[model samples]
Target: MPQTLDAAAVRTWCSLALEALGREREEIDAINVYPVADGDTGTNLYLTVESAAQAVEAVFAAHETGSSVPAPADVVRAMAHGALIGARGNSGTILAQLLRGMAERLGDGDHLAGALHRAATLAREAVAHPVEGTILSVAGAAAQAADAFPQDAVRAAYEGARQALDATPGQLAVLERAGVVDAGGRGLLMVLGALVEAVTGEAPVAPVLAHVRHEIGDPGLEPCAAGGPAFEVIYLLEADDAAVARLRTRLDGLGDSLVVVGGDGLWNVHVHVDDAGAAVEAGVEAGRPYRIRITHFDTTAPPREREQVQRAVVVVVPGEGLAGLCAEAGATTVLARPGEPPASGELVDAIRRAHAREVVLLPNSAELRHTAAAAAEQARTEGVRVALIPTRAAVQGIAALAVHEPDRRFDEDVVAMTAAAGATRYAELAVAERQSWTSAGVCQAGDVLGLIDGDVAVIGADLADTAEAVLDRMLAAGGELVTLVLGEDVPDGDAVADRLERYVRDGYLAVDTLVYRGGRGSTPLLVGVE
Candidate 1:
């Protein structure tokens, strides 16, 4: 039985697409040969779909508070907006545009064929120089097929996409020479197949790529040729239509494979350029750009024989200073932004990037326990020995890192690090957002909150006063060392640390104090006693 194109179907489509992409990511990456062949098309598509799925979930969560469910328009729009902001690479950026186009039509109550046609048009328009036999061509074919068979649009579109994917090698000279289909087109076909399953409750037959199993040096299977752009630059920009138009012209002159996708004053910009700095500068001139990422094309060695380190530490931190501190300690650091926590895939990526035989993962938050465990399990399946130390806070992770000895036996090192983290007690100072009752007492908005071991233990009107009271409470049990991490937003942070250090020195006979800046997005202060 065929399902109607509604909010539920859209949700199912995102889920199925993400799952399919996850299973096919590595295979897709292995076949990537065009547009510089950094070999991350599958990963990019997976991440983009993941973002869209998360956004759709967020909508459902918000609606759970009420009796009514979200409408199809809301769900589709959220999916498109999420993909646009989280889009990565050239293929991912174009996919975002395609989703946006479909959303524009579907939200307006257009049929499946009309939505597919709009998606194909918008995706082609998003690319600076649309080429034949790319994802765009496959998209056009899917739209045409959908139009021709409106009664069975989803299945027809998927079949059309599979045919286009098979014909890609014949249409693109590079793909033909490499003996592989267009990687982007292949990924899009998977997405369409997922849609077919979503609408009709039946999975389509998977398409097998030509020469997919061929080795790097196999006859008729040429590897990705070198010598293209030095860097791939991407950024999210907040700009008006006029500014984006000018930016498109400026970027077109700077590099090739340019893709600018988004609307309603926000855009995702991607381009491959020799002068990476100039590309970024152009974005700055156009609008306020942030979350900028620039990747050098020549960083990794060939996948076959890359050497792995004996041991490595991967930790999550809350701020730039902490990231820098952990990096200096020879650990790979993942920055956990205030509202956006890293997904398990990101952790898995970090584990791979560490490129070590044995890895120690410190999530640095109690909330990330499941996510960390999942990543560790995934890494283990890939043959990396991963030890997850359940450090509930950054301070605990710091203590664990302090005791990490990579030269020691893996088990011994892990035991020592775990013990060190378990022995440390962490607390933080935060401002109250609203009036609420706490373990200590009823608190009003604008009150300073002192949390000890994840509980609100004290509340005051002054930062210094609240911090001192919290420190006194934590030190009552007797501690040898006091570690203070001050946020960048705190006023007179240096003076506060100095005052607290003097207070501890004068009060305690032999206890020591060390202070560090947590930089932006940190709590006002974090205190760890050991």
Candidate 2:
């Protein structure tokens, strides 16, 4: 049964498209041969869709406290705006324009055919010279199919895009010579398939591109002929339409694969040129360009010769022992001392020390969320791929690290670690410094406070008593495993761990407990229930 096109449907579409792209990213990159292939078309498209999905999620989050759901128009518009601002590479820029075009028509009405037609037209117009046998042709074909089959437009459009993708080789000399379809057209087909899945509750079968794998020889081999542009430059510009018009003309004169997409005082500019600085200077003359990214093409070097580490983990630990523990588990550690958190620069430094092309950053403290995000952005500017997992405690970080697998796809590994962290509930035992009010109740100086999920949950006179109380409370909610980390300064810390381990074994059926000693300057104790 097909669902009506609405806010929820649009959100679903973005999510499905992002997931589809992630799964096919490497395959698409293998087949990339047009507009100067640097082997990142799939990654670029995935990032673009990820931004759009994040924007849609933000809209839902904003409306969560309100009485009404966000309107469909608002969701679609946010999706387009997000793509426009985050667009990367030639294909991604065109994708942003296509979404923006559909958004323009969809905001006015719910006619799918009209939106598809507008998207195709805008995408073709965004390119400097409309080329056949590309994403533009696929979009045009989908739009035509949608217009012809209004009742089953989503499925018809998907089918039409699939056909166009298959015929791309015959239409383009490069694709024909490579024995592969257009990478951008294939990506567009995946997006259209996602739309079909969103409208109807079933995913259509994706077309096989086995010929791409056979023709490309090795996945690492660059398929395109050498000697195009030396650099690919992209930036977001805050400028008027007239300035963008001039910027497009200037960029077209500078190099090939010119794409300028956006409207209403903002634009995403993408071009490949031998002189990257000159392209950027043109943007400066036309408008204020920010988020400017200039990537040099190493056309002479083989992909295997690139000095890039595959992946690594960087974690922020609260104590030396925890740091050592994480380091032993193959992570790069940044120690945060008592009463002092590591700054964003420190995290960036740790990321650099890891020397990985892709890094998973675990800033295991709630207070460092913004700091970690800033560090991730800075690292991205330096060409280091970073994913920040929000683990609010050492115990949560432990949970995440336990499930980490570097061999898996980056996105899949991040998802697994995030899920493991989220499933574990964390708490800490600390001595109060002075009289204070808390979620549990008031506590006097020197009182032992048990904080669950960052809130005071129990206040007791003895460490053992308080630990027992917290365990009982946490177990009342049902947990299979209990992780305890004892502080070096805590008196009789071993005794407490021993007693708690026995307490859990005797009191709870099928529940297990593990203990670790958090070296000097650590919190009194940390607990995790999972």
RMSD in order of candidates: 3.0, 13.0
Cα lDDT listed for each candidate:
0.88, 0.87
- The candidate maximizing lDDT is 1
Query: Which pairs clash inside model 1?
Result: none
After superposition, which runs of candidate 2 have C-alpha atoms over 4 Å from their true positions? 1-4, 208-211, 215-224, 304-530
TM-score of every prediction relative to native: 0.90, 0.63
Please report how far candidate 2 places residue 253 from its true position, in Å. 0.6
For model 1, the superposed segments whose C-alpha errors exceed 4 Å read 1-4, 61-74, 107-110, 208-226, 299-306, 432-447
Q: Per-residue lDDT for 1-530 in model 2, tens only?
A: 34236899999999899889978877898888786667778867876887788778889999999889999999999999888876878998999999999999888865888889899999999999988989999999999999998888888899888888888888888777777788888888889999999988899986764335574445444444577788999998999999999999999999989999999999999998999999999999998987677888877765564365889999988887888889999999988876446556558768987989999999999988987998899799889999999999999999999999999999999999999999999999999999999988899999999999999999998988999999999999999999999989988877888999999999997899989888865798999999
Each candidate's number of clashing pairs is 0, 0
